[model samples]
Target: MASTEFDFIIVGGGLSGLVLATRLTEDPDIKVLVIEAGNDLTSDPRVNVPAMWPQLQGTTSDWSFKTVPQKGMGGRMLEVPQGRMLGGSAALNGLNFVVSSKDNIDAWGADLGNGPGWNWEGLSKAFRKAYSLTTSGNIEKEGPVQVTIPEEDTKWPQVWRETFAGLEYDPTGNDDPFSGKNLGAVMRTRSFAGNAYFAQARSRSNLTLWTTTVVEKLVLEPSSTRVTATGVQYTKDSSETKTVNAGREVILTAGTFGSPKLLELSGIGEADLLKSLNIEPVIDNPHVGENLQNHPVCVLSFETDPANEEGFETLDKLTRQDPATLAAAMDAYSQKQRGPLSKTNCNAMAHVPLPGISTEEGKADLARLLNSTSTAAEKGKTPSAFAKKHEAFVHSILTNPRKASDGPDGRFAPPPSVSGDSGGHFTIGVMLSHPLSRGSCHLANTRGELAIDPNHLGHSLDVEILARHVQFLESVLVKSEPLASHIKTKRCAPRPEMGISDANEAKRFVRETAIGASHYTGTCSMMPRELGGVVDPALRVYGCGNLRVCDASIIPLMPRGNPMATVYGVAERAAEIIIAGL
Candidate 1:
């Protein structure tokens, strides 16, 4: 086993880890070492091509985690496929380069008071600093991460514009929502985050990118104050275990599940759980594995009368029904990188407020339900011990604060998966972006994977929001013109077989159908300690000196859109903070 020391050691070479390493190495005087559990994806086409994103999950590239059976999702064990490689999930992610909403971004300061730097102005600059926009089909000279909004050559783009107009929702024409525009039906901007952030840094001699290295535990020593993270114990290529020391600092960018699991293994979690599991504790931090959050999305299905180029009929059905057709598509893709396989159907989307979409009575009922549960504990309530511990979590989410985007915390976007890999359906999703439900990520042993309890839809408030969103979509999608002329009136999950009619039935339908958006955040949250925050506003773990987390795990709340853009902006801010100290 070879042991090498560095000024800085970053665990997990995913989106945040790569971004931080690239930024830190800019100094050249400082050396950075990155340890990734998965192999480098430098030459993998599945990790590069945006259209192949759906096929990546559960493959060697993904740490295909399965959550404990969730009551909210009808006792189903949903898959949690996190990236395990260099460049990480950033390479395998749904390729939307959306920067979230203005109000949503502002909430980092306005609601949670995460500080001025986390606000939209600061994050917006970071977003700009991270990418160069592109449209032309060029890769060699453009950004390492190219956020592209292709030219209006496709028929679906115009159809979507007219359809949104027909619905009277303003289409924010070419304004680039990344600039702060939150409302409006906007087309997506795509990027491969891993390449955009890490490719250029590959040649830097000061940076050592180590792949297939699993961090076994964090090496820490008790100081007069906080426990100092000295270095780490890791193994490369399975059997060859090695120990490396960090002279300056140890940063945890291993993402939500990884960061928390590492913390638990290193004896920095709730003392009770630690004791129960026979692990000694250095810190009895009750918040380490709590406040796990995700966007529970409900997929809505439709049959397109005249399909787009990347529609299901040309992609899924062709490949499924005929081998010759699949061969032809492969040939076309290989020849010019142009074919139905080169794109996906989820290029356009919309966000709506609860009142704007739901019936007045339904809205009233939702408010009443939230208020009832949100009321002060009764004198004799005797709630569950966990509920008592997370009272702050419940109160904080009632405001849906960090997700304080203009809407009623609802987002609808297209995902390629439901667009049918074998038939005549194109699917869109209605996601409760700021769900009130909470879960946890714990560890049994160092070798066992994280015991995840995403507890999806555990809170009834999310069910109301999802049901209303679906009801609104059902009312508008096929009944109206433009989109009406295109989509056939049908349901996929909440189909006629599901018997979904009343509010209760709809809620039940949601329980059985909702799937994760995979945007996990808040395990090592950045709120006050009482509110179950694992890290301080500065992204430092509460009692770990010289140790900080610069990943999605520190996000107190999931943004009102996909969390990827927000992750990039946050990482940029983190780099700035880390550099200032140096």
Candidate 2:
């Protein structure tokens, strides 16, 4: 029997793991250990600064993995960036703190019958627990994360709210976005932990964290018919390998990409892949590496007229192109939390369905392209591994309870000014709220890094939906008042010159412009065994005792907006689930 160093051994010290460690250690008696691969970046400017999020990609803070050339996406490869630091992507991401609607949460829980605890009412409590509700009546203020809701009088958000209200695209319906309906333009909250979520928890003497350490695999001991996970195998430097036992459970909170890779290495995936990798099969669970989903986004930017330059232009200067400007902004932020650094990459948001959202002809055409057999032809390839399941997912997203009328088919957010940009910027983007595409992350060898393929826009249906949004936003929607008057030049991606009506042209355009929203989920989905789920609704990994996953990886589906708030809530609920078992 291995010596148990802690009651729970958490694999990653990322967002979810930190939340779990804090929750579990509140009892001071329970021992927990968090093993993190990246160095503790608590106060690293690359992490704490919201504007520097774009700068961190492909840098030390990012995993910097690239997708296998996406055949569906004009044979172009995408830069799949995952945070390698302490808070994981949460620390490296654009600080847009937002949550899903009640209807959206129900789709993942009650509607799918996941569990009572997974539903809206159940998770809403976790939402409040994770962040103290601010004056916006949306987020929490006193929690580990400091959430700043943009004042109603703020310039960009004010303009966006008025523009959206006049258009009647979708009324916000309620003041608090967390109350459920978030349809109109509203200023969003941004999370600033002040390097705290884990730092503050250091006072809890029962917790231990290993930084700059890599988790090799899980320590599974088999007994006759079943396998029990006792602990984890990890190493600080390749020269030394150590095993830390977990008396209660071994939780894998290693994000969407890291968790599934850990499971595969531990011999809990498809038999063929394991055999090929020379790893012994312990569970032969095919679902362990399947069901990967992420939101696909595209930005359509326009050059704002210099004469019409308002507060939006000041945003461009704050990107810190000059040393003096950067120093000045930092000085201002220290004095008062109100500065350009306080703003998010996106200032305001809206959700809308295209003009043809309900048309029969549109649906039929999409169906033809998304059909399991024909989809490969669109990509100029043979059949894909997940063709049929993704085909079904495509139809479901379009026909689910959250369709054009109630839940938006796509989301729109005001764009941030880019550094070194020639002119003022105004962008309208299309968000594939529920993407049909699937991808996987698995190890090719015993190496620390894992091979990943997000399968971006692999489904032809996504291209069709996003193309429609682009056409509508530019030709039909943006051509409307206050918004149209501000645009001076046609400096945009999927340029206005491209004929969007032509299907081939639209497909080519979508392929060229699409980018990942970094909201990766469903890799280690919590669903029923029959549906090829890796984890149960209780968050326990199937076919294993004392092994579980608590992170974005367990998110069975992608929610509407930024996943930070949702991920935080999931961690909060995971604490409840783990406590019940204890």
Candidate 3:
């Protein structure tokens, strides 16, 4: 059995949790314990293999959460799959490495409530501290994660860049997207945290990782004036519960949904809600489970022209589980770690503003959207200080010329469809970077059951913004050459008969088909307490001295891309902050 005490007890062996464990235990005397809810599948082929990520879904490795029916999404319950294994979502994510733009990251300090050292300059250093970028265009030797633009087996990514360039979009040139401009066709990256960060540090004697162990709650020291977390109570394999002591501090890195749910369960949420549930209230912070934000994406798929089969080699056959193709892919990966089975389908992507944000008419339209039916009014309440600050940030991004919305940040060249009958096709994922809508995740009962409500497209402006981006994809992006030459006029989604010819039809289509990107954040916001903050700039929970949150939950503003890179930067910087205090 692992020791019952450590210098630090991390309450989730996910991506951030493991990063913290690895960095903190660099000192032989600093002991760390990571408690995870799932088993250690480090050696699982389904995890190590790149193309096999789709197979991990719905298996024991996935949390497989379903949001409450979102009225804005035609009353549909979207699937939010989180990783339940030791690597967390990194083990199950699509493996597209993208960093946020400087404008968006800087907004966290200038527009939002975050103070100094949270801007792009500060976070970008932390970003490079976690991952080494080694493509033909850019190369950095530092960091544990090996991020690279793989040599693809298809000509689609080149064709994708050329096509976008024809439409007046600039290629990233020699610059990787890390410079923060991020407005061109930069090749998406292939990287994972399981082997890069965790594997190297797991053998450390001072670092203890307990898989299949569920953290029930944080052990709080009772005090009327201040809140302090001293340890955690957890269970292993449905066995009897046990408590572990934290010698210095207790950190919550259980991700967006898990972190806030843990907070509420540990008597640290809204006072009235805890009292009604017959649980003792340690700290009365209503924002612990509020400010939930997620990137909503609508995938537009096109039927690939059968005649262009030579230049447009996609994973259509493999995705359909064709016996021969699967066997060939398995043999190639098992033998040489090269071939179609080695990388994810995503290769080419761009972060652009709403179709015509530079024009005067575009500014007027956005201003009208911002002023009409404010965030609090739409939710049938008065706006809080934080809500207003959030609104201003949205306004700034929408109106700014330099900042792009990550509309269709990702466009996949290979066939992503899993339908048994799904033939050759190309797909583009249109994503809203900074959504104005905010929902929440809270405890459903005293048993620690959760009620997750993403409220996708809850704000009326979200529908308008995302619909405009979708229309741009069908009308302009798909119509361009090089890419258009390969795809047929007929589309798999938004079929020819669907009549998505205008903005109204596009809005309806968005409402019917959009789903969450699973890049959940902002539940435990980092800001001043008066601005509805759960944790302060130092990442310490308000009214608590030793308790802190270091994960996606503490992101006050949503970053512009896949959020994997941003998470790593935040975790790397957090480790430094924790170590400095020690």
What are the Cα lDDT values of the candidates?
Answer: 0.69, 0.69, 0.79
Ranking of candidates on lDDT, top first? 3, 1, 2
What lDDT score goes with residue 99 in model 3?
79
| lDDT tens digits, residue span 440-556, model 1 | 899966574678998898776678767866776676644666656655666543354664546777788788788888889878887667656787767888888689988888877
TM-scores for candidates 1 onward, in order = 0.87, 0.87, 0.94
Alpha-carbon RMSD, each predicted model = 4.6, 4.3, 2.5
TM-score of 1: 0.87
Q: Write the per-residue lDDT of candidate 3 for residues 1-582, one digit (tens) a residue.
A: 544779999888888888888899999999998888988877787777777777889988888888998999988998888999887998788777777778667876545657667887777888888876666766787888877775666788788778878977777743555776442211222345667788888899999888889888889987767777889888888898888999999999899989998888889888988988888998888888888889899888887887888967777778777899889988887788776778777666776777778888988887787778577675522137777777777777878765677556433443344355555778888899889888888888988777888889988888888988888888888888888888875567644466676878988988988889988988898887777689887789988889889888988778877777788988998998899999
Off by over 4 Å in 2: 1-4, 136-143, 151-154, 171-174, 181-196, 311-314, 323-328, 358-421, 494-497, 501-503
Q: Any runs in candidate 1 off by more than 4 Å, and if so which?
A: 135-144, 150-154, 181-191, 306-314, 318-321, 355-366, 373-423, 492-494, 499-501
lDDT of 2 by residue, 382-466 (tens): 1243344444444555644235421222112224434465555666667777676777767767564666667888765677777
- Pick the TM-score winner: 3
Clashing pairs in 3: none
Candidate 3 has a TM-score of: 0.94
